[model samples]
Target chain A: MDLLGINPVLLIASLMVSATPILLAAIGETVVEKSGVLNLGVEGMMIVGAVVGFITAVNTENPAIGFVTAAIAGALLSTIFATLVLYLKSNQVATGLGLTLVGLGISALLGKPYEGIKSPTLQSLDIPILSDIPIFGRMLFSHDAMVYVSILIVGLVWYTLKYTRVGLVLRAVGENHDAAHALGYKVIRIRFLAIMFGGACSGLGGAYISLVRVPQWTEGMTAGAGWIALAIVVFASWKPWRTLIGAYLFGGITVLQLNLQAAGVAIPVEYLSMSPFLITIAVLVIISARGNQGAPASLGRPFHASN
Target chain B: MIHFEKRLNPSRITTVVTPIIAVILTMIAGGIMFAALGKPPLEAIRIIFWDPLFDPNFASYSRPQLLVKAGPLILIAIGLSIGFKAGIWNIGAEGQYILGAVFGAAVALAAYPADSVLLFPAMVVAGAFGGWLWAMIPAILRTKFNTNEILVSLMLVYVAESILASVAQGLLKNPEGYGFPGSRNLQQYPSAFNAEVIANSGMHWGVISAFIAVIFAYVMMTRHIRGFEVRLMGEAPKAARFSGVSTTRLVVFCLGISGALAGLAGMFEVSGPSGQITIDFNSGYGFTAIIVAFLGRLHPIGILLAGLLMALTYIGGELAQLMLGLPGASIQLFQGMLLLFLLATDIFTNYRIRIGGSN
Candidate 1:
């Protein structure tokens, strides 16, 4: 069925694809924050992932290998942030900004050669039985492998955080690093691993954009998706399940705007283009106004054993 | 194995020495990067750090360009340093700068045919107001709703960009220029042009304002009670609150001042150096100012020096881009490396390394 000269089914399908990158990034950041470390370099990590992924996919002619390399690159970059903030005690915010600068610059440098070249895009995976099951099948089951992986990752995160001993330890560290340290838990090591995982997820998200969404390399292609993912983490109240909802909502807005522009809607294109960021601000205000921000106690605080 | 011991007092010497060490380290690392890119490392390094000032072929042209570039950076960085000292992060100075330009340019555009001598000053006020208005969104939201200003301010940057794009294409489009998307070039308008006070000296109103801001910031920081309160708010928020410092007021004031300054910088740029408002008018000066603020150790005089040094790298980087086949992004990478090294080396200021010591 069509609404305002737009196909609802196609819009739903496209939004699922569009939301995967943000969903992956937000889920990853949620875990990092849960471990009492805040890495504000999500944009940096994602853009680097996008370029490295694009380069690898183009060279190897395998989108899978491209994604793998992007994750590795993202993790490697986050190691710089982890070492600086965790070991050397650099300011997390400044170091994160530096990481972004480095990521954007380095990505542009690396992606320069690959700018116009198109990589092998990800193919959609259709589950046999689900694919044949009418309208719901087309809406849900038909998507690239990464979309399914993103949702699966969200479910896994939810289950792990709610029921696993690992989750309990991570929560303990985030709530009180001193207590966790006193209790013989390795705060730094746990936090380091969490940060790397976050980086990897962010990398995958970026690769999704380069490989599946845009299907080509471009400088600064991630273009504030990383930042939006950050806001989504807050909008989701740091919950994994809510992150899925938040991503979908934002993805829907993005798709709707594009569709509206294509359909020649009466509203000014500038106003429509700016709606997502404006909505983000409004959402932040609303979420924060309700009083229970639910942020980790030691979220941005530095951890030192002697202290 | 080495371990760190907390110092009773942060070392005064290391505070000054670390930044220098960071710069040297950045050059070495940046040289290595250039070599990896298949260029001569030494030449690239020399071109970036040395050639702009001492290279006879480019010095005359690049030397004056230094003040033109450093002026806005210093102005924005000085304002940012204050809020940073209060532990308030206003990373959206980029948005504020853009709004300032849009607002300032609007005044010039509105009074297109007028030749009043007061037009430029009126535009300056409007520019500052625009930045202040943009900044106030985050400030008010943070104070009233307890929202994170960093995210809000940054998101508004995108919003401001949309506005800038809209105005450039719609409301502010130069009517006489056929179908171009940018606003009227303000440099041609005598009443609104921010011209150099001295010929070939690059001593425009913006550069003079930057100097005034530096002096004003230094005096306020060293002598004013508000300065002490700002420092206290950053160092120890609890104590500052207990001592009757209003958190809300400080947040509003700091954000307001920084926004206004950023706006002023934007105004100067659009009217003088930039000459017109276009889609890509802002070239990341607001974001770069954050690094300048930190590199200066959040000190006014230090920012003055750091702003000039940062500007040197910009000019030098451009020279390298012209002289060598290096990508434009290499300069960004170099600056990023500088900030990273600075952060890594800053550890020495507050802690001492103990070799093979047992806790």
Candidate 2:
């Protein structure tokens, strides 16, 4: 099939659609980590959101509501996590793993009835001038609302963290929890809200997978996107804008390999699929090589009230 | 204002009872999940806990099968327990498992139709090396680059699965088997087969290795200075550092053991019950072993019993599907519920629950 002899452009366009899910999820997780709580159950929550979003989209025939509803479902599920880590002070890592197992199981069970059904499509949007650009028009500018929202989210998050008073308080709480508590701030409440917001963003990301990327329901279809998002958070050094760059970089690698397979490279197709993960690891190593200063000072450390 | 505080000196009785309470709560939550799924809670409960050991029809087949399933699980969990104990998370045992199978099977296939006693040992070594090498990817990154091992290891599983799919379809595809995508049956090859040493009891080399691993783990965790260091690292990283435990060394040790044991589990599985490397060879044994490691309260004896109990669910769940026309996925969900509720109810391990209202 010849589409104006620009196959790579088409491939890049498709990659953007695929990357949207991870982009949204990673951005949210970046904020969550910045706030000093490490939630490993992103994969599980995304799966649950996928099922809920698909069922809602199929039932109502409105993809927008379906996406919002999925985000709500994810936030509600994350409240369970927040209750444990924030209120009960459970280990975030262990609790997050448990959440993933439970979320995967629940989604599998719920997704059973809706198995083999198609989700409502999310069509591309066209702007007045940007969509009409010569070569790089539709590929970059025209996308589903979720993609643009994720971009906007990146900008907004960056701005907030860099300039806002609330960001100052949140970062303060993350960098030094006991001092923040002594300064008359609500550490638990701030974390709860941050976790919930992150959950919502992640939920929307899963909704994008069901409603756009795959456009069908399959168990474990979120694949390892949640884990990728987590790594990308670290890859970005816990910054929202860098998270976008890392996500799209991953997305580009992910898309390029598939294109290689389509182009019938001499290498095996299996290795093509594996390329994204290998590259992600390579990137992680490069970013992490900066050593002790890369990670957040408070990542994975539980804050007891007294401490 | 009323406040809740953990007692500095809790009784040993409370320690014993908390896990027991966790068990009871897990069962109750599990039963509720089964009920919601339109299955009888009693039947589901019976099938999960009791039917595997007592039911006449399934008991005979499942009794021997228990050791078969438990062997790999115990071996993998024993390795994982060490990492967890040392606060080094290696979540990609599934990837390690697949690499092991692929590496081991590559050898057996390379020597196609050649009968020799050394073939099996060579494959075992290759398989263990494969898993250990895969695990080292994360270990090296974590120690050298300060990368998160949890993400690095977990993501590698997908890559391993792709390798499995590609190899099973391409290089290892049986020539005489009419275009099927799987290796030759190693069980038929006497030199490579891991046959049961004790007939009718599923007591193979794998089971023996599992028992040996448990014994060694028990000794290492209790008697050795390394064990003390591991416990210290997990509970108090600063204290562990000050106490002369090298973080890098612990990372290597924890990840290396887990990878080697997981590799052994994979090697045994390929040579024994599985017989060949096929597409989707891993049935989440690596992931399920995580639950086993935790459910056993991270102890050697606890892991042994947890392995048996978890294995019972696999056998009984299969029986339930065969007899009751239920989907196999449901059983996975049910088992997952056990872990979810277990974690949810374990809030009492450190903190005492205080009533919201007081006089």
Candidate 3:
């Protein structure tokens, strides 16, 4: 029998699971920013996803449908945001914050009945040879489909951003929307699609939490994960590979603090819990100090297309 | 052929009518949502907006609460509107609010055994300073490193929450009480309490401060050179620089003001309604203030009216939770929808849409 001891490995695994939501949310936010629209409502969207996903899973007895429904709900919510920012030319920051407020309210109303009930757990999938491998296996490969898909998403997004014509067009639009508009491209359409895609990704990330991570609906369940993800997007400098690095770095610190808490270190649990935010501030400082992190030139500016 | 056109002015009637139209539309949409939830849409709408202010049983308690809840929101939003107008986003007001509570509570706790009038004022000043100091971190970082203030300030809220939880649980824990995770009740100490200045009327120092903030904000926006610069900066950054406005100084000023106001609100909550520095004392006022700032169209008078309305919803929401079994957070969402709808309809301010599409 295994002796009564602090399992660093298991603790780390749980941390990864916790960090997954942030990673997924931040990655989506990074993409949204890259396309030159700063949508700060990721937290709102994720929480919406959490409630929608939880309700769907509960009703259907299927987690995959829950994930899909969550993504759709998130995108639908984001569409409201898109209509305002894209068509109305409202301040992105203000409208995004408003979207968050709306999301939080809607979710709380939706989730009141679902509270305290455990969601059906998301099954972990094991890769054949990778599952047998040491600590690296569980940490890297042998996990839920969402984890691997997030990695694949990062790679795909990076490649598409760097290589494809669509990537060039997107980057070009972000670099100068006015210029892109003159070149006969629809600036509003591109930004709209990007915003929706970001919302979808954020929704799935929220699903991972409600359906798998905590496996329960809690008030403010995403608990500023959306905000952390928003910061991580800035930390990554609108780059996909950098997003991966930024996410895991955040993930690592987040997990380490929890492990320290469970390991019963001398440090207070409050300090450990607060470590992720502090680390984010520290990392952002370092990134800015080092130099420009390649933030898109047109980010957060409302593009009014009349000459 | 190219047509270059500018529509500069709109009738005063449209300006007032647009927000009402947006509100009506939001209600219709919200009704659909309620229906989807299997609730009577009209009843839900009536309960959300109307009954709180008019209903006999709830109105007595909720009427007084309106001023109390609105007080801090108005103070915080007025502070934030200035910064937002100056093109400096201070999203960390939540952190500032928490820090304010912590600092004020710390002062109250340190002077716990001392029953002196100086205790409350000292704590209020300390709380304002606490928020100012927290906000300054981002201002300095942004000025020095050219860092993103949005991320810096927003992230600090979590740090502030952690600190709040830590202090509430350990350092400030009431000794006489059996290990509860909060400080001594300021309300119990008459010298430190922030009770109504006028008995039975819901008038407190916080409400008084909110009125003062509105007057100050109005004067600043209308008659002051600094206010002109703030509006100019948001509309045209290049023009602001050309007009010899100091971006760095303005950043510090705007952020400092917002943080201080937010802190004061937190201090008031700790002293008055909340009465103690508990982990759950903050009810997302910082985030909600962003809503008030926008809903009020970033104007002081607008915020004053908007703050009152938001306060009503908060009181109404609590009532709904008790009576209709509606969740508390739906109020926040309803308030958010006010901004969303306002922003969406604000397009009419500049552009007229044709039936098929904009022409």
Candidate 4:
């Protein structure tokens, strides 16, 4: 009972905070995949963002600048992948994997000096009267600006994907590249932009971790959150709002596990530690069992104009 | 404007030549990186690529270690290449490796003080079985539910890591020692040891298995129908299915073989070089083997050479770190750059850039 004595408001609030990174990443990847580009280097891109954001924040003592730089860094890394897969027509899977390797290695090398370094903290924006409300206020109103920014991004992505002509064209390109090309849509250019957007969001996610969540720089600090974000895209069935749901679900599991550990729950610490990964994957398998009809038809295939 | 023209027939010369070109480019890029870090570029490059094999001072020690390090990489890559050729990606060989080591060590530990020679062989089987079982999760899920094997397998690695930490700190803990977090040193146990067969040559069972696997894979790919089926699936899956190749069977076969080989690598490593089942026993050999498989162009002979080259970097990277005061991360960055360069140059194998071409 004591272990179960969790404050629901606090849990929901922290869940939103924890989910922000993956939400940012998954929503961004949703856009990229919607445009028919599959980039598995999200993990790599996020780590680069984490290190770059940490470094920028340390130097400027400004979290916003840190986040912007992280986005730039992430977008920059994505360009390498875009160039390889789109221009050189390299195998998408292999190139994405290579991108991840590059991101991880470069981040580690660059983050060496920043190791054990504390990042400048971002203050949570507490809405004056809204934050004063007993339970809901604390849950909904008290978070760093990035939390709201992630939700806003999600809403914007959803609106863009569902209502906009650009979204239709992106979807058409993903559904059938040749037809889209015949229709005079520039497939490569569109995919490149989408990938860059994905990179930016992933960067924001990484920066959020370094600046707000852990508030510290560590090697491989993003850990497997990038991978989880990838899974979240699939879990969301490529829908932005579902992506939000999936992220919060994952965030809930993560927060709950940590809370359980803190409360000295009787569960084996190892299982608790592994629950996020195991549960996320298990749920993905279950969701996929219903069918992954949401996957872009040309998702993993490289777009060759000639082919 | 220059545009790439698809080759009607991929150049045979380019197939063999691109890896070499990539290596040279890596050296050049790595030298620049060293220069950026204030170290003498040539000296850093030499220490990494040349000194490991030729320098009289370090070659004696590093040369033998090359095979020792390459042993697991080649064995794992050989198995992975087969799966890769079948379009079946098993990215969690690291997990399979850990489970294999755990199962093998558990067998030996349970049979403590026993002198039966069969014990080591039994452990090997148990190790292989453990890996096979671990790999089956993703394989079965993929076949039955159409789940993405890549995500499933990769996530399993984390689960396996948690289990590894738990086992090392709990059941497998060396009780005789003052609360240490590892198993009994299997290297010290006569019956369970994977000792070097040849004196100081690093010719242990794992290295021997790697060579055997290389030969076996080469022969299988060239002469076996199953190998042809595997290649067909990867190159053209629809055609493979039409040719009566059971997709489920191929997936199971490839995943099983890779898992078993990864397990053997872990078992040999734990009992011989690594000396015990520690929480940190895995040294990313399984993941690195993925790079090795690709670098080898998914060919057996190519994988062997790639494995050796990669191992050289590991040894040379450590040496460079010690001698040049370079960050240890520099090697990881260098290797990543090598893979990037390799993939970039691979474009030449299938296409040629032509001047003044329009589609």
DockQ of each: 0.79, 0.58, 0.69, 0.74
TM-score of each: 0.99, 0.95, 0.94, 0.98
Write down the lDDT of every candidate, Cα atoms only: 0.92, 0.85, 0.84, 0.91
- Candidate 3: lDDT of A304? 80
Give the alpha carbon lDDT tens digit for every residue of A140-219 in model 3.
65688777788888888889889998888888888899899999988899999889988988998898889998889987
lDDT of 4 by residue, B1-359 (tens): 87888888879999899999999999999999899989999999889888989999999888889999999999999999999888798989999999999999999999997899899999999988988989999999999999999889889999999999999999887888699899999888999999999978888999999999999999999999999999999989999999899999999999999999999999989999998988888988888898899899999999999999999999999999999988888888888888888889988998988788485
Residue-level lDDT tens digits of model 1 in A51-162: 9999999999999999999999999999999999999999988898899999999999999988888899989988899977888789889888999999999999999888
| List of chain B TM-scores, one per candidate | 0.98, 0.94, 0.94, 0.98
The parts of candidate 3 lying over 4 Å away from their true place are: A1-15, B1-15, B352-359
Q: Could you report the Cα RMSD, in angstroms, for every candidate shown? A: 1.2, 2.3, 2.8, 1.2
Q: Candidate 4 at residue A117, lDDT?
A: 81
> Candidate 1 or 4, higher lDDT?
1
What's the candidate order when arranged by decreasing TM-score? 1, 4, 2, 3
Sorted into a CAPRI-style docking class, model 4 comes out as medium
Tell me the tens digit of each residue's lDDT in model 2 across B53-141.
89897788889999999999999999999999888999899999989888988888889887888998898898889899999989998
lDDT of 3 at A61: 89
Clashing pairs in 1: none
| Candidate topping lDDT | 1
**Candidate 1 lDDT over residue span B68-119, tens digit each:** 9999999999999999999999999999999999999999999997899889
